[model samples]
Target chain A: MSDPGTITDSGSSGEAPVTMLATPIRLDYQYTAGLSQSRFLQGIAQGKFIGQRCPACHKVYVPPRGSCPTDGVATTDPVELSNSGTVTTYCVVNVPFQGQSIEIPYICAQILLDGANIAFMGLIQELPATDVRMGMRVEAVWLPKDQWGLTMASVKYFRPNGEPDADYETFKEYL
Target chain B: MADSEVLRAPHVLEYPYVRSVGPVIGAFLTGLRDGRILGAQSRDAQGKATVIVPPTEYDPVTSADVGALVEVGQSGVVTTWSWAPEPKKDQPLDRPFAWVLVRLDGATTAMLHVVDAGSLDAMSSGMRVTARWRPAAERVGRVQDIECFVPEAANP
Candidate 1:
């Protein structure tokens, strides 16, 4: 038998290089509540906006809270809310998130409802993206009356009220 | 983009939140076990008086220690507001509703909260509101213990 350890290069050959590949991953978060946010979820199941009040300051908070920002004590009362509001400031959500419901290039807006003082975040719908603007009067679109639940998704999205567009100066402060 | 041979694991990160409170906050929590609301004063800082639920022991801007802690009423007015058309897992009102900035009767500035009204007609600036407390059995040291505010009276 020939020598077991023998170098056999198949004629003329040069060294070859090595390479590696990678993939891009996105972030997805699922939240669980011990207590505070649970009330917000409860309200959504029934189709309502909830807020907490600071007993020290007497300020009512939307997305009702467990703790008051001022007094630091847990608020006791739970208040229900109206669904209508005005657009305060907003950004067009031309981009899309994984598992998103609305189509890409939709609008994500900040709306200031008539009675509440603070702003909550959410999406707008039913109207063309170009038609959305700050101070535009919009109304909530419920999830087909029977399908309501304890979540913000209870209201499908906001729709245009057909009023003339609000002046930019009127809502610039909210941005 | 698709490749049959590709295999990868996603990167994940978690961070802890560290919060420090001054004297007012300490007293405010003391009040919670007893069920009370306290607001701190801006002795060195000039501004309208405001109520603090958690009782900020120190002025946010001046960083001065607020010595005087006082009780606040449960009613207030909407200073400014916004709506959350959709809520995530644990917002106060699971349904669509507005978030408002409320300035209590004696306070100068505002705090945040949610309101429950069926439509825009149900809400307005200066609308009076009251706190809806959670049951005592559910009381924890946290904020959501109060729940969300509802309209005091039906809108005309």
Candidate 2:
């Protein structure tokens, strides 16, 4: 091989004809889950909700990450979170896609689990899609223990928790 | 907690891509599919003829248009190598193998490929090796068409 640093200034002599061929490639990859995420997933499997507290900001994160996005510091404190929380926002999904497990017109909501600073998205069920709204309290509906594993899928979805809508002032920061 | 353990599970991601191999590379790949190895003919700044295996369209040193297509021998010498004690997914072989740079008989540059020598003890720089091509029926215009290289002495 030629030294990569050397400049090759010789212009093409332009002597030969050109042709193109089609080539297709397929690749597969496996990614290992990191520490914080793995612990969160394990907690879900055991019917427990866990969050990490950023030592600097004191903000709690459910589905904990290694570092605090805001302060750029490690979140070392693990806090158990309540399953019921308020929906900070939501969207109605009407478009269909391949291999979709749910029907069209489902509600995907972002819930701020009680005691956690960050919110996570989950499917909303039981109530009419149009009735799902911000500030509405919802609780996780877990699958049977036998079906639990190292996956968030253990929580089938979140449904209305029968609590009155939380005041906007209570979850305004999460939105 | 200091004593806490992290959970893990297998996850697979896959994607399919299509690309066009232009004139120079197209010719090379087509040659592979047809059971032949082709090299690009080029000259250095001093006007010395050089044949680069797995041909590049232009001369690497002078950037001159490559001269012509040349057929090279299947046999080569391992210029250097590293051992893969446990094969990863999609590697040429499942057992231990050596990832080597081989300089084909008539080529001036080396190409990278795996050498399935069965044991690390048999692999070394300067050892003679030959392309162990897949059966004609299974030949695709891709690099894997040559399943891997094997020690020349072990060739049947």
Index of the highest-DockQ prediction:
2
**Consecutive 10-residue window with the lowest summed lDDT within model 2 chain B:** B1-10
Candidate 1: deviation at residue A126, Å? 1.6
Residue-by-residue lDDT tens digits, candidate 1, A57-113:
766667756788767888657666677777888888777665687787788888766
- Mind giving the per-residue lDDT tens digits that candidate 2 earns over B1-156? 333465445565444445777766766766777677888888888998899898997888899888667779999999999999999976789899999999999999999999999998998999999999998778767788899999998995
Residue A49, candidate 2: how far off, in angstroms?
A: 3.4
Model 1, stretches more than 4 Å misplaced?
Answer: A1-30, A96-101, A162-175, B1-156
Candidate 2: where is the Cα deviation over 4 Å?
Answer: A1-82, A91-107, A115-117, A126-132, A144-146, A161-164, B1-6, B11-20, B82-90, B94-97, B116-127, B153-156
lDDT of 2 by residue, A52-164 (tens): 99998899998887899999999878899998999999999999986699987999999999999989999999988989989999999999999998788899999999999
- Cα error, candidate 1, residue A107 (Å): 1.3
Best by lDDT: 2
iRMSD values, candidates in order: 32.2, 10.3
B130, model 1: CA deviation in Å?
72
